[model samples]
Target chain A: AQSVSQHNHHVILSEAASLELGCNYSYGGTVNLFWYVQYPGQHLQLLLKYFSGDPLVKGIKGFEAEFIKSKFSFNLRKPSVQWSDTAEYFCAVTSGGSNDYKLSFGAGTTVTVRA
Target chain B: NAGVTQTPKFRVLKTGQSMTLLCAQDMNHEYMYWYRQDPGMGLRLIHYSVGEGTTAKGEVPDGYNVSRLKKQNFLLGLESAAPSQTSVYFCASSYSSSGGLAKNIQYFGAGTRLSVL
Candidate 1:
């Protein structure tokens, strides 16, 4: 079974402030990691994913995440934030290496970007 | 192309009432999924289908049933609606490769907000 955990429940940041949201996962086998964002009145959108190759993955709207294998973490980061960035972020995982594509999602992190 | 579309944007049902939610995707993806989202709970998988005429249970399939009669359509049914079944349901699809690494970049619908009184 694959599970995901997001450390922060709610985050409040000012515009132009750096941002980092913690995410961790536990699965016996290898797993694929992803970060998804849900803006107000919108469906969940894919931020970025880490399947293979480079651990540092960049996403739309200036968002990025690093996949640390040793720590079993895939934390989302951004150099600067905007008020429009306010949204709920989710971390998800799926079994890797020919396993079925069943996604397990985290509780989510609510970001409130103050302008 | 309409990536994924869910019908009945909002619904309210009385206890013991039954209803069905419709989902359609035009991307010709191979994998389709149904999930429910609640406050603080994120998205929990209810059921999924790999292809037409095939359906499988997911993390939270006890209270819900799903069917994939056609390749582009997936239906989720609530036989006996309960208060616990009230949630925002989302449908998603992905193009899964036949071999290693199924490539799971899911495209999601706007979601259906269902409330059971």
Candidate 2:
């Protein structure tokens, strides 16, 4: 079975601080990666995805993630953080095989950006 | 367009009771899914539907039943609720793999918080 791992359980950062959340998966085959964010009292929204293209993918709200195939990691990053960026972030992955449509999500990382 | 909506934002059920969760989408998506979110556990898929009249089990489908009688509606039922079933349930919809766009991009609903005591 495939599983996703998020190393950061909770992170507290000041405004304008750089952000980096680590994510890794346990699958060796072809895979599709995604990052989703859930703001306070808001639905889960897609931040970015990686199928087969540039390793670095930019998403909404000045967020970006890099997919490092060799490391089996897809880490989410932001050059600078804002108070509004406080939310719970999830890293998910799916096999590129026939059942690639199903997603396997990791334990989310809660980010708190203090102003 | 209300992408995806789940009814009864919050519910309280006693053990051994029964209830059904309603999920509706106006996006005309061919695929619908049910998931449960627990503290520190992210989300676990309970069931999914490829199309109307077709349902399939997912990662955790032991105590849940699903029905997709209409293309725009998907229902998840708990025949006999248990305390262990208390969790936040979410419904999502997305385009199928056969569609031009990738099937991994899913639109989720505002989840339903259920408590069984």
Candidate 3:
């Protein structure tokens, strides 16, 4: 089973500040990466995903992520964050091929964007 | 369209009590999943189903049982609840992409917050 690791447990930043949340996973085989965001009292929503092609993928709400296979990292980044960006971010991974039913998620990073 | 729906948005149970969590999807997806989200632990897979009548154990399936009698519904049952089982439960559904041709993204439902006391 693959294990995902999120570097920061909590992050605090002011509005318009750049944001980056580090995420790493442990798996040697072909893996699909994703970033999910959970707003306060809301369900988890897809931010972005990287299956193949360009390592960098753009997602909703101006969020982006870069998948570096060499480092087993898929870090979420945003150049300028808004107060609404305050949410819990999770990194998830699933092995490629037919066995993609299970998703391994990281511990999660809570980002608080101050206005 | 209701992609996925979970019943009993908030539930509180006593220890050793039994309860069931219902997850329904109208997307006609082949894959359904049950996960528990804790404060620090993002989300841990409890159980999953591949097709209408097939079920599989995930990373943390202990104390949990799942059944998928119908194609659109998945039920998660806890025979005896424990305090450690208290967490926000989420149900998700996704279409099975074949031959790695497309993305197998899962759609989640508004979580069911469960508290076992």
Residue pairs in clash, model 2: none
The global Cα lDDT (0 to 1) of model 2 is: 0.94
User: What TM-score does candidate 1 get on C-alpha atoms?
Assistant: 0.97
Model 3 reaches what TM-score against the true structure? 0.96
Give lDDT per model, in order: 0.92, 0.94, 0.92
Q: lDDT winner among the candidates?
A: 2
User: Which 10 consecutive residues of model 1 chain B have the lowest summed lDDT?
Assistant: B96-105
DockQ of 2: 0.65
Q: Encode model 2's per-residue lDDT on B34-108: one tens digit a residue.
A: 999999999999999989999999999999999999999999999999999999999999887654346688999
The better candidate by DockQ, 1 or 2, is: 1
Q: Which runs in model 2 stand beyond 4 Å of their true positions?
A: B97-101
Clashing pairs in 1: none
Q: Encode model 3's per-residue lDDT on A19-113: one tens digit a residue.
A: 99999999988988889999998889999998889999999999999999899999999999999999999999989776665789999999999
Off by over 4 Å in 3: B99-103
Backbone clashes for every candidate come to 0, 0, 0
In CAPRI terms, model 2 is classed as: medium
**TM-score of chain A, every prediction, order shown:** 0.96, 0.97, 0.98
Q: For model 1, what is the alpha-carbon lDDT of residue A53?
A: 94
